[model samples]
Target: MIGFLWETFKIKCLGGLREEVAREVRRHLRTNSAIRNVPQPFGYRMLKRFYGKGGLLSFLLRYAGLYAIIMLGCAAIVSLFPNWVPKSGLNSDRLPDVQNVTSYFLAAQAVMIGLLFPVALGVISLITQREDASSTVSDLQVYYSESFAFGVGASGIALSIVLAIHVFWPAGYVLEYLGFSDAGTYFEVVLLIAHLLWLLVNFAALWYFLVTSLSFMRPAQRALMRRRYAALTAIPDYLTVHLLNHRYIVRLAAEIAKKVGWDKAKTALLFGGRLERGEVELNNKALSGQVLSNVWQKPLMWVIRRWLKRCNKVEGAVGSQPDLDFCPDFRRPLSDDGIICRRIGGIPLDKIERFVVGQSFRFKAKKP
Candidate 1:
């Protein structure tokens, strides 16, 4: 029973915890995808939602409320360390007061955030936009714009609260309430830690945001996309013409490949399972001819017969023999053989009696 419980904890409980964490991370990423699309800064969005642009007093009140909350939180934490408050006229050896210095530092941060906002917006504006609304490039635009605004706004808010604490009222009077040794020093230490952490996190975020933006302009990835989508440009504007030319789909595809400088082999591979570099998530669905399993054979045969009859390729014959017994590999479509599609594209077929077999044929079918 003990062993069973241990196994359950090891496999089920621990494993579930990891799975839950991963699921939550994915959910957060999806949430960020939406958040990134919101272009406005936090302050603007809040103002817009709660008060009209004309409400100047409401705007001031909003920040005042924010400051009040910050002070309450400070009091809450400070209350835990009862002796945190220093006595009045806590003499200092240095000429420059720490409170004044801290305020100046935080005020500088507020100014810096203000400066950073316009520059970030400008740099983001330089990102070339796609004409298509449903484009990955556009998605990136949304992500950068929203994240930048959020970062700047958050930095501004934090700076404001920190500045206010120093400038207006040093959080609750320094009284030895908790009576812990050097409680006043602990409070000063907390302030220093907060300052260091704020600088560290914000600067790191800024560097990361800028550096990652450079990787977005990948020329090779763009070229691959150009090759992929150049075919869409071939689409005729008229619906009737498009429908008529649908029969020539293969030829049209070939034309696109040729236009994009793909050879016959590369053309065959244009829609094949991912063989090209830089495919992040390649899906492996059946491409080209399907497996003729026992369950599928009868229905497939009927379809083939109907299609052949329509094409006038088969007539009233006594018996029509197809090499159904011969097996073609169906191990996986995204394997190395996937480049050949296991049908055509230079894949050879097994020969049965009176069957003609030669070089591998290229099958045009793609995964359904």
Candidate 2:
């Protein structure tokens, strides 16, 4: 009796789960716009075109051009007069203290470098096919955002306390009590601390800007953005699911149904009575015997099986031809689309052959 109850409960749970999955699938199909008509961003379109046909040399040239532009802008800014620098600390007519100016420059550079470094690392890692780099880059964004906010808040509070002490109490007397021999040393220490605080503030402000901008996006838009980011940054493990064919998706659904302990007939219904190869054949004796013992259930099951067979015939007819024309320009040796063509157009054939041979030799050598 206990075993029978457990089996019944399991069957109900599986049925409920299948219903939920079918509902989500129907919802997605209804809401998603026609694929060809979906508007894409200019930047994404440009990237797709570039990666489609651009070689390694083109990639290097593109980044080099960007680097040159950034360097030129930095040089132009640094050539300005010293007086242009903000006078937050002290008003001195003489050329601002070299140490203080240099410290400020270093702090500013550190903030910019810290923000850009992770993005560059992620791009390079994607090109080199490193999954670990993608994970690191994702974590870096979260870490920097949180750390910057906390550091700036703590530094601001500390600075406020110190200023209050200097304004109300005798700061010089306090310094003397602490055994500071010279005013220059004390001022230099204060200058260093100020630069550190400035750096933290800059980082936190930029991070807040990023967060604020992203917060404006709707939940669905944000999810789509993250999915695209993940696809671009990591090797495509499930690329076939996005291709023009529905057979692969159907087969995947069938496998999932089997894993969840669905019997053959229920699995067939889930997949519209069709496997990847052909229609599933039902055992008449089993269906009429123990499986459909109730007289009412027998008729309902017969209708369901007939409906599944019709759906399978429709699906088979629709999938008889290739769904989309294969574009030559978008081929990559490691991608599913490229596998069908067996060629990488932009890259040199000799280089491709040499890389394949080298990989094969290495594999053979690794085998005992």
Candidate 3:
């Protein structure tokens, strides 16, 4: 009885955990549409679609143009105030004094915070007007845009604090008290450090936004593809079309592979089996000496056999295969003139079915 319970726990309990995780992932994908609809940055799709002609020019106009306008506008504002703009460049023998450095930093921060308002508004507009209504104008989108604005705004404020400490903290007085004669050199070092810090902070903010945006969008894209696949399947007589298309067949094959583990499903199809009865009869000839000539391969074969054993023992262990009602003809025998007999994308449907529905040939695994 103990052995029986332990066996059940390994086959059933662990399998249940795996199923729960997959279901949660699917649930997240189904509900989170913002991830799917967020725009890709850097005009990546545009570049791909229109590579040779004006793609580069178009990208620059759309993205870089706005960036340049913001930056140049800030510079223009600073240039207007000759007193605020630093007269001496970083390479000059006499570095800009603390007052000049502070002035320039304040001017840049003002422009950055000012630019964020319009950018946030644009993000909101983009989210609310997306073609997929399901993904648009949700609380998540509002939060995403608002959070981005807040983060960028906060970063600008933080830059101000850093600059204040690095510039006006009297580092020269402290260096002189420490017996350093070159106060200008020490002040120059402090200014250089402040500039580097400012650049670092801005770069970090940009990187954070890019990474989070991409991460949010990737799962949404996968979910969208799954929805598309589901829609394609809903069309009557689409199975044959899917089987006929190399791309569709490959995609369908991958989905089925995930549903039933590749090795177990492949074995069931190749050797033929009645999984419900916990007996997967193997073709001895298929596992002949020629296939097992390499001694190292024997361990892998043993592992495969063990996995198949556990799979058979587990009740309702088919990974994610849909109900029979959904695909009534999934594993049905091919008619003499049926499309299954025809070669698709260089492989016959009969051969493809072996991996996809081979395990479902005899009995459906009880749905857990």
Candidate 4:
């Protein structure tokens, strides 16, 4: 019965999750546009990596596994030196400190969910209304951000259960039920330390959430976001059939994706990389749009791009094809619509590669 219930619950979280992520991506695009705000996880970006990756157990394993270690380390120290906590003044009935802290802790946890739930829903509703897959980069950001926010809310609920127990039930009784010969000094130290740690983590999450929320208002962030939004919305039109399947551009994209933060597998999945064969396939064009995101969108040398495209069609009739004639430029397309990324990545690594690096790697690396 327990197993059956667990399976049902897991499905609710995992089922159609990718589609939901897609919907969120669309929603966040609209929300950001209406407010001219940049949509990103910012402080919560770490959670973005696992957005649509798994179910509840995975979240607990990742999130709990991360936070639990701190509490466990504290517990281990208390266990190792049980005598460190003097039993003389210890109260066996309850830890009075817990009563004082539980209310605030529960409130903080509540705030985490409060902030996350609405953001997730807003993203969902906004995207649902517009339903545009054009702004793939912004959409992807919104999707992952929504998934991360909602996932945190799920875990916060579980933590709130513990917080609530402390509020309504005696901590000593709860500890006794948790297991032990008695509610002793060692447990007290571990419990108090754990409480403090949870408090700190909750506040930290709140800080990040608040910072992200306020980013919508900051003039600088909004201007930057406006520019990026212009870039993102233009990406899809450039992603027409030929560009979607371009091998070299795809490779350059995959390389940049690797340098940014995507694992080899994800990069392969996105750009369909095969370095040995020197071949590339664009598996997920939308994701590829994300790969090429944040570049300065502009039309650069459209006359040259069109002439090049036409010239390339008959290049075999020529004596030899120069790199300039064979290779394409992104500035024209992404800027004015010759292509979505007509060499916007800066001149160093073709066009999109440098943009991917600065956008994904440096931007995220600098994020606090």
Candidate 5:
């Protein structure tokens, strides 16, 4: 029993870690895809189809919330350390009474972590929406516009501060190693300038990374995180798209298309022509051939097809032959009714789940 429990615990832990890794992978993929599409001018115009203009106040409130939550989290963690926050400020050098103050602070931290963590996560999730929604445009516009510029400016300022701090409060060992004994004026200035430039470049890289991270967040959430942390604000939208596309939706779409048919537009329209122009001509020729090749097939197919042709029903045929398998994929058209068409023909019942069925293959409703 103990061994069994141990094995079960290990499996659960592994599952949790796997989820975390998958999440990270998805984030990175979304970022990369966003970056690749950045240079395409017309794409931005196309993105407008996704959403309307975003409001400023709602956006501000989101970030403000994020800032408050993070600060609260920090406060919680710090509260645990008695030395950091004493029960009283009079004895700065001495640690706070561990027994007296620790329990209260720890309890407060626990409550804050429990309450704020979920709220922060929800706000953060909005900041970086994974779903294809209207909000994407507003989020994207901010990252490419003011947020990105702010990152660059902030990075520059940070770099300058790092340089000043490093140079003015120079460590004696580092200065002496560089052969600057407070005598070599010109050489020291050159070294300082070089070091400053290096620092500036590093800061810029850091800024880019941060701004990109913000891409995953909603504009309001990003704003709040930025207000609180003063970190990067840019995010790679492509990465999110890419991750989601591959890991979930698009992959499923592709699999369904491959199983049923490649002509997405034609399938979507529930029409005869293929999606691509060349394929349309080819499909037309094939239809003509299908009519001629088996004169009895269409009539037989038509008779069998009529069973499920009612206002709300499914219809199809079953055959071992390859071509007749096409009709099996079809079903009665969908309308105002809440029903979805379902049928299985040449394929086994177990395998039918993989194929899309309905009026339009793309508008799949259920497992059938």
Candidate 6:
């Protein structure tokens, strides 16, 4: 009885899931004018483009909330510090002493550096994740190695220029007129400026590295093909179902779906959507699939990809000639008319391949 009940529950769950998926697919088909015209994911963009829409206002609010929580915790820890480190009785920096002024300046600089370290680390980590797929301890080493090299090089160049102005030209002479009489004071100002410049250089380097690195993630030849295919393919039925299940995103998706046509809007939605789950099929039979899997995984991924490639080639030569031209690019025709074309250029390639090769062909025509 218990087993029967469990089985019944499982059946109901799957049925409900399928029904939900179908409803979303049908809804997009009906309401999204551009759906049929555009590719997947972008058509789904109806769901997840809020960050683009809201811009700085939403970003500020998001970061502000994070800052508030961090500051609150910082306040608690700061409160505890006074109890741990008691006030000194010594008059090292006595009242009204010049030494006190210097000490205060040092304390302020120390505090600033303390605050800046974590901020720098966080920025570096976030930028690295956006730009680099390397996630191991070695990733950190590489990040720091590059970062240090860049920082030192930048600082050296900047210091050299500033030194030329101060030493070779006698810009240091002009500083005397500006009431920075002491050479030490002038040097300190230059040092501070150099520090600020170095910080800016670090940020610039990070941004540059991030953009360039992520761009290389895709193979040069495949990027355009993948994009074209993606546009043609459109989002799968499942993603639309997943997005509409989220209340806020559903409203956003509906609005975008109105203008971009259902397909483009859906494509956009999926691009922006926060994916809760994902799965990848590793099929070396598809060269592109094998390449992608190898790029994403370990030696095992490479081995599986190579094996699949060999099998695909063998299977392809054995298949009937009719099946050879299956999955021909019929996007232009498919877009121009709602009709799904099976034959390529009036040739019954699929049937010919099957009949001649006398083997099971896995490739199907790119149509329903």
Worst 10 residues of 5 by lDDT: 277-286
Q: RMSD to native for every prediction?
A: 22.8, 25.8, 21.7, 17.5, 22.7, 26.0
lDDT by residue (tens digit), candidate 4, 1-368: 44345544433543222223334454555565543454554544444333324444654555455445544553455467655645422344455665667777788778777777676566546545665657545654644343345445555776677667656545344444544324344545565566667556555655555554456345475455455544444432344323433533454344433433323431132222212222211122222222231221111122223333443466351233222211122221111211222221111133343333222211011112
lDDT digits (tens) for residues 174-194 of candidate 3: 444544324335345445564
Tens-digit lDDT string for candidate 5 (25-90): 545545665434433335323322211122334323433454345334434534464344323222
lDDT of each: 0.39, 0.35, 0.39, 0.42, 0.33, 0.34
Question: Which candidate's lDDT is highest?
Answer: 4
What's the true lDDT of residue 366 in model 4?
A: 16
User: Lowest summed lDDT over 10 consecutive residues: which window, candidate 1?
Assistant: 353-362
TM-score of each: 0.34, 0.19, 0.28, 0.37, 0.21, 0.20
Cα distance off (Å), candidate 4, residue 32 = 29
- The deviation in Å at residue 175 for candidate 5 is 5.1
For model 5 the local lDDT of residue 11 reads 34
Look at candidate 4 and tell me the lDDT of residue 330: 28
> Candidate 2: deviation at residue 110, Å?
24
Candidate 3 lDDT for residue 126: 57
Q: List, residue by residue over 1-368, the lDDT tens digit for candidate 1.
A: 44346534533433322223334443554465443353444643443333222233433454456545544555565567555555432232221355676777776667667766676666456554444545656444344443344544565566566566655334323423433223334445455566655565556555544543443456554343233222211121132233323312224335433443434432242222233332222112343344211111222223323432332343532132221111223223234323321222221222321121111211233346
Sort by TM-score, top down from the best: 4, 1, 3, 5, 6, 2
Which of the numbered candidates is closest to the native, going by highest TM-score?
Answer: 4
Residue-level error in angstroms, candidate 1, position 19: 12
Off by over 4 Å in 2: 1-155, 166-171, 183-189, 192-207, 210-221, 224-368
Angstrom error at residue 171, model 2 = 5.5
Off by over 4 Å in 3: 1-98, 125-148, 164-169, 178-184, 193-197, 200-368
